[model samples]
Structures are given as structure tokens and as C-alpha cells.
Target: MHSIAFRLVAEEEEGRLMAQRVERRKLRDTINPFELPQSLFEKYYRLNKPGFQYLLDVLTANTEAPKKAFAISPIAKLSACLRFLAEGGYQTGVGKDCDVSNKESCM
Candidate 1:
């Protein structure tokens, strides 16, 4: 009985650790361009800080709301677009790099 209890506790601890790891991975996958430093932002998006903000503001201003479920934030969407342009990569490549969907990139 003691052995069984110990095994169960070990399994529970492992599950908790797995959950924490998954959460960390999700946070890492969601790249927040706004949170990046100016130099890294320029390196990735090929725009200066002010220029990026201006374009982001314009894009956000003109952005239409999604008709149904929640959508990716405007900042993330714009960052993906800029990365696509700067990298000159395929939509899927950009999507993978930005953690966006290829269909989202097309839109």
C-alpha cells in the first residue's frame, strides 16, 4: 500500500511538471513584438521603433473585427506581416516563425 501511494504521488508530480512545461512553451511561442527591444525589433521587422509603431497604429486603425471567435492581436499580426516581408519567406515559413497560421498570414 505504501509503495502504491508513493507511485501515485510520483505520477501526480510528473503530471504537474508536464503541465508547467507546456505552459512555458505556450508563452514562449507567442512572440510579443511590442515587448521586444528596439534593436531586435528592427532586426526582425526591418523597421525602426517609431516607424514600426506608426505602421502598427495604421494597421490597427484600419483593421476590421473578426466576425466570430477571438483573433490574434493586431500587433502580432502586423509583426508577422513585417517578418514575412523582411525575410522574404513563404507564407508557411513566416507563419511557423511567427507562430501564426498560413491562412492568417494570407489574410
Candidate 2:
């Protein structure tokens, strides 16, 4: 029947859409925040290198360890947080700056 054929076509379309969604999701490339020049780092994070290192050291134990291989590192998380605070921008913008694809990760 035409209804049965339409149902099959719908299922095929759904499968193709799922494949496209999967293909679009990929691990985003990240940059090392610590590798930035000291001035640029301070400018973005509003903290000097030593202060940032101290904060990172203090917070490292409190931060959740990455469960997945592609999970963001604590350093990146902190950098994103500080950047968000310093820049007063949207989470997505901060995520892009931190190379985090997930805006929630920037939070």
C-alpha cells in the first residue's frame, strides 16, 4: 500500500538524518591556554601566570577528573571560566575561545 511505502521512506529518511547528525559531531580541536604569551594570558584570564598556576593547583583536586578521553582538562575548564568572567560574554563565545564545543562545559 502507499502508506506502507511512505512509512518505509520515512524510516529511511530518519536513518539518514541520524547518520548526518553523527557525522557532524566530532571532537573539537583545543588550544593550550597556558601556552599563550604571558601578556595575552593575563589579558584574557585577568591573572598573571603565577596566580593562575596557584589557582589551578588549588582547584585541581576539587575538579572532577575526565571520564572520557575527549573530555576537557581542568586547565581548559579554568581558562574558560576565567575568560567567561573576564569577558562577560555568552557561554558559547567563551566555549569557542576555550576550544570547547559544548557550552555547558564552559560553565
lDDT of 1 by residue, 1-107 (tens): 99999999999999999999876456444656766667766777889878988997788788787665545567766777788898888565444554332223334
Q: What C-alpha lDDT do the candidate models reach, one value each?
A: 0.69, 0.71
Q: TM-scores across all candidates?
A: 0.53, 0.56
Q: Put down candidate 2 lDDT per residue, 15-93, tens digits, no spaces.
A: 9998876544442334466667788778888899899889989998777777897666677677778888888885645
TM-score of 2: 0.56
Per-residue error for 9 in candidate 2, Å, reads: 12
Q: What's the C-alpha lDDT at position 68 in model 2?
A: 94
Clashing pairs in 1: none
Q: State which candidate has the highest TM-score.
A: 2
